[model samples]
Target chain A: MTVYEFAKGLILEAGGQVRSRMDESIQVETKSNPNDLVTNIDREVENYIYNSILDTYPDHQVIGEEGHGHELTQLEGFSWVIDPIDGTLNFVHQADNFAISIGIYKDNESYAGFVYDVISDTLYHAKKGEGAYINRQRIKTVEQTTLKTSIIGINPNWLTRSKSEAIFKQIVADARSARAYGSAALEIVNVATGKLAAYMTPRLSPWDYAGAAIILEEVNGVVTDLLGNPLSLIKPSSVIAANPQIHEEILTHYLSHHNEDISAFHQYLNSK
Target chain B: MTVYEFAKGLILEAGGQVRSRMDESIQVETKSNPNDLVTNIDREVENYIYNSILDTYPDHQVIGEEGHGHELTQLEGFSWVIDPIDGTLNFVHQADNFAISIGIYKDNESYAGFVYDVISDTLYHAKKGEGAYINRQRIKTVEQTTLKTSIIGINPNWLTRSKSEAIFKQIVADARSARAYGSAALEIVNVATGKLAAYMTPRLSPWDYAGAAIILEEVNGVVTDLLGNPLSLIKPSSVIAANPQIHEEILTHYLSHHNEDISAFHQYLNSK
Candidate 1:
């Protein structure tokens, strides 16, 4: 089977496994901080995907959220970036809105990507040089719209705690409306599908956005750090994924004026 | 038929009509402000529901989001409150996450309430003395969870613009996480279903919380203005809907410390 086919099949199977496991009591734990949650299902799903990839393509490397493939950092050859459960807090609390995301890379270039909304049975996937699809139905590119006519997704915490808090607060006021779904993958998918004009965050890891970056790019959406720089596939960075128009507008009008604040934030992120 | 049965049937049918009309080109307009959006579908659905209610119970009064029943002031007899499309911006842009909300009242008391999620076809409804349901499945009362272990939903705008910004900022920081779904009705439903520990806003119309208040109360959830006062059935007010434990804790610990800020905000809302 082609690499895309194998990845798609594995993600679907993993989603099914997650759905079945939801009925049983979930064991929860925290990492990094008290609010950052992880569940037994997340580790189990990651392990299953990691083993399955090694068994099928022994030469391919894997990097996952649960640290199964953390040692293999460089995307030198064929590598898979996986977030077994993209929204662990949502998964544990709401039992909905979480997703399993996977991105396949060849020599640091995106090859294929998939984000499976397990509860909704919706799969958003794309391959290099090809268009994106939601459950096998092709999705249209985001229509051109301005900030005043758009709906953006942003976490409320950023508006309160980020170094560029004032800048983000202005952006929230300027936009037509704002929503926070608490899932980066789903918010990025919403941008690709034209549901949200933009989705921004102060920081996101590779596994949090790798799959979504591929799908968004396929549909003419732009994914970049807050400084308008391309995101690193090997490290966490501040992210802003939006349609082409809003992306440029925000970078120019909003983010450009506050370089000092944004730089400070990025420097803080790097220090961490 | 009983008021609950008739209201549920009409809401389901209205949801069907709204879904069918989504395929057509929508006419958009703003009410009160540029960000406040309304669409042709909203008017059509409200009109349908208003006419259907009057045709069935001519003596019953109706109050709708659109101006269909705005003149009706006193809820001395049987009354119906309707928000044909609760999340107009979502309906216009994302085409999902919006809902149809209706609450039936008799002499200022809740008789029945229904909030239909059109895209998913899930109906959350409740009668005064009856327990709440989701598409006929009985939902449990909100589970006991602390602020540090709970997920609450609050519009980010409140954190930026309200008089209680600093207080709300603290509340958000103290919570495990915060989410904003952009629809008051759906957010309140999330509180009732225990998907969200609490949902609060600076101000919301009676139509916004009328339906959700009944559903939440049926599930042993508390619905009140931010100051812990009961919501009026004929006017707008600040809202905080939560499980019993969180409700008491938040009011006692957080909001009570800053009554001046909250009251000033409420006064501004009343002035508007």
Candidate 2:
């Protein structure tokens, strides 16, 4: 099978494993800190994907959030980076909001990515040079919807910490709506699905943005640093990914309010 | 059937009706302001409950968010106050987070209530002096949990406006986690399910808190004004509802930061 086919098969299989496990009471463990968590379901799901992929493609490398997989230096050749459950805290609390995210890289470049919001049964997938897909139908980033007409997904952390609040307040003032779903991976899926016109976050880790980055870009959406530059897949950065029109408008009007912070945000991106 | 069963059945049936209609495109109209919205599905759902109940109990009074039902006064005899879509913003944006909530009262006292989060398939139900249930299984309110070990659901507005960010900051400084789901109805449901230790919000109307109020109380949780007095079914107020111990700690420490606002809030509640 082609890598995409193998990836999709594994994702669906892992998703089913996840679905069945939700009803079973499983022990939850704190990861990194109390705010972050991982359950046996996460490891079980990740192991299923890892074993399936390794048996199918032994040469391919892997990185998974559960620490059940490798720690990679370079993203050379075929490498699969997985986050078995992307909103783990939400999953621990609500048994929702968590996503099974997988991104495939060939020769250090993203080839395909899949993010399945398992509970909602929505799968957002994309292959580079082709297009994005939500379920089966091919999808693209929505057209240049104006800021005032846009509904954006944001993380509440930025509302207080990052100087982005001015931009955020302006975005809220300009957009149809503003929301924070607490999951970067899922938010990117929403952006790709056209359910969200744009998504911005001041800081995200490489693990948080990798899967969704491939999907968002494949759909013709722009994913860039706060200063309006493309995101580096190998590293995390402050980002504004949106419909082309609003992305630029947001970059122009919203970024100007915090020109100093904008420059500093860019500097932080570069340092990362 | 008892009033509680009647209310639960109607609420679930109304929810199913709303969910079935969700796939079909419908005209959405702005309500109150652009930030708020109402769809034909909302009115249809509320109307279904209203007509179905009136058919059996013609003398019963009904109040609904859509304004399609009666303007309840004095709450004499049986009354059903409902919010067809508790989180219209979520419904409009995410097609989820919206819930069907119905609050039943007998002789000016809340008797039965149900809040069904259609998408999540979570049904939080309660009956006066009986208890609360989740998916028909009894669920008691969470026992006394320290703020340091608790998770809280807060309204974003309060974080930005509440004069004392102490409780907010303290909770962040102390709690296991903090979140804001943007739906008062769902937040209360979270408390009933023990997913959250407490829910605090300022400026809520009767329609928003009615169903949740009944559910939280049934679970052995306490719902009170910021001053630790019982919340009124009639007046809108700033609320801090939690497991008893946490509720007292939150009120004494966190809520006291805004002493000046308390009296004004009291006045507002009394005036309403």
Candidate 3:
């Protein structure tokens, strides 16, 4: 089967597994901190995706939020990036607002990606050349609107921290409104589907944004760091995925530091 | 039919009607201002709700967000308060995050209340003296949690406005995280179901919160204004709906003004 077809099948099956397990008493554990949680469902789902890919492809590499793949020094061949439950806290606590995200990249180029909002039964997917879609209908990114008329997604916790807090607070004040759904993939997909104009956060891992990043980009959205540079797939960094027009507007006006090009930071990822 | 029975039937029916129109192109119109929109669907839904209630009980009064009822000097008899689409913006834009909210009040007391999230098909309902429920399962308000560990629902727009900005920013900073769903009813129900520890917005009309307020109250939550007083059913005011334990905590610590009760403001309703 083609990688896209295989991925669609695996995601639907894993989503079914997640739905069925929602009612059962889940076994939960903490990682890193008390608030950060992982349920057995996450592990099971990640394993299912990992096994399904490896069983068929045999040579493809997989990187997962649950640590499913090898620790590699370089990206090579077909690489799968997945976050089994992007909002594990929402899943464990509210039984909703979480997503199963998977992105398949071949040799550093976007190939296929899918972000399934499990509870809502909504599927957002895209291929390299094919346009992004929510379920079956094709979607385009929202029109470029100024900060005063846009609805952006921003986590409230970001306000407390110092790094980007001051800058983000200004954006929040200038924007029409802000939202934080707790799931990065879902928020990014919301922007792709025109549910939100933009979504920004200070930190995120590859698995957290891989799937939605491609989908957003497919919809003519700009996926970049806070300073309007392409995001690095190997490491976590600040992210601002917005429509093409607002991407530069926000970067030059809202996110820029003294009119300096922030491309210097991205050199680290290329050197890796 | 019993009031509760009649309400349940109409809510589901209205919800179905709303669902059917989801795909059809909707004509939007502005109400008080540019940001405040009243779609053809809102008027249609409000009219349907008004006609349904009045048709059943001529003696009963109906007040709607779309301005269906009369301005009365006295609180008397059975009254139904409704917001056809609680999150109109979400309904018009996202088509998933909005809900239908209805509250039944009698002789100044909260009676039967319902907030149905149409897209998710989740029903949150409650009747006075019985219990609050989500669909069929009985729901209890969330347990007491400190601000440091709580997840709050606050509109980012509120952060930009000055009246409550300083205090709300502190709450946002103190809380573990913040979420802005853009729907008052959904956020209030989220608090009732423990998905959110508290939900606060400085100004919302009666129809915006009437129904969810009853549900939250029945679930052992405290539904009040910013001043820690029971919200006036007649006028717009700052709202803070929280668990019983933290209601006073938030009002006193996060939303208080010089340790004085703001009940004096309610006199305006009496004077009217």
**TM-scores of chain A in all candidate models:** 0.98, 0.87, 0.93
**Model 2 lDDT tens row, A1-272:** 78998888788888877888788887888766766777888888888888888888889888887774444667778988888888887787767777888988899887999998898788888888888888898885566688765677764444454356555655655676665566789888778767778988787656677788899888777788777776654555787878788888888887756767777766776684
In every candidate, what fraction of the native interface contacts is reproduced? 0.66, 0.13, 0.59
Residue-by-residue lDDT tens digits, candidate 3, B1-272: 78998999999899999999999999988776666777999999999989988888999988888887748545578988899999888886678889899998999888889999998888999999899999999996578877777778888766655555665778887776788899999999999999998998767888889999999989788888777777766787778888876787787786665233234434443444
What are the lDDT scores of the predictions, listed in order? Answer: 0.90, 0.76, 0.83
The C-alpha stretches of model 1 lying farther than 4 A from their native spots are A162-164, B162-164
DockQ of all predictions against the true structure, Cα-based: 0.76, 0.25, 0.55
Error of 3 at B5 (Å): 1.9
Candidate 2 lDDT, tens digit per residue, B15-103?
A: 78777777899778986667678888888888888899999999988888777444444677898888888888778766877788888
Q: Which has the higher DockQ value, candidate number 1 or candidate number 3?
A: 1
Quote the positional error of residue A246 for candidate 1 in Å: 0.6
- Per-residue accuracy of model 1 over B1-272 as CA lDDT, tens digit each: 88888898999999999888778999999999998988888888889999999998999999998986677667878988899999888999988999999988998888988999999999999998879999979989788778889999998777677575766888887888899998899999999998899998888998898898899999899999989999987778989999999999888999888888878877888787
Candidate numbers sorted by TM-score from highest down: 1, 3, 2
Which is the leading candidate under lDDT?
Answer: 1
Better of 1 and 2 by TM-score: 1
Question: What DockQ would candidate 1 receive versus the native complex?
Answer: 0.76
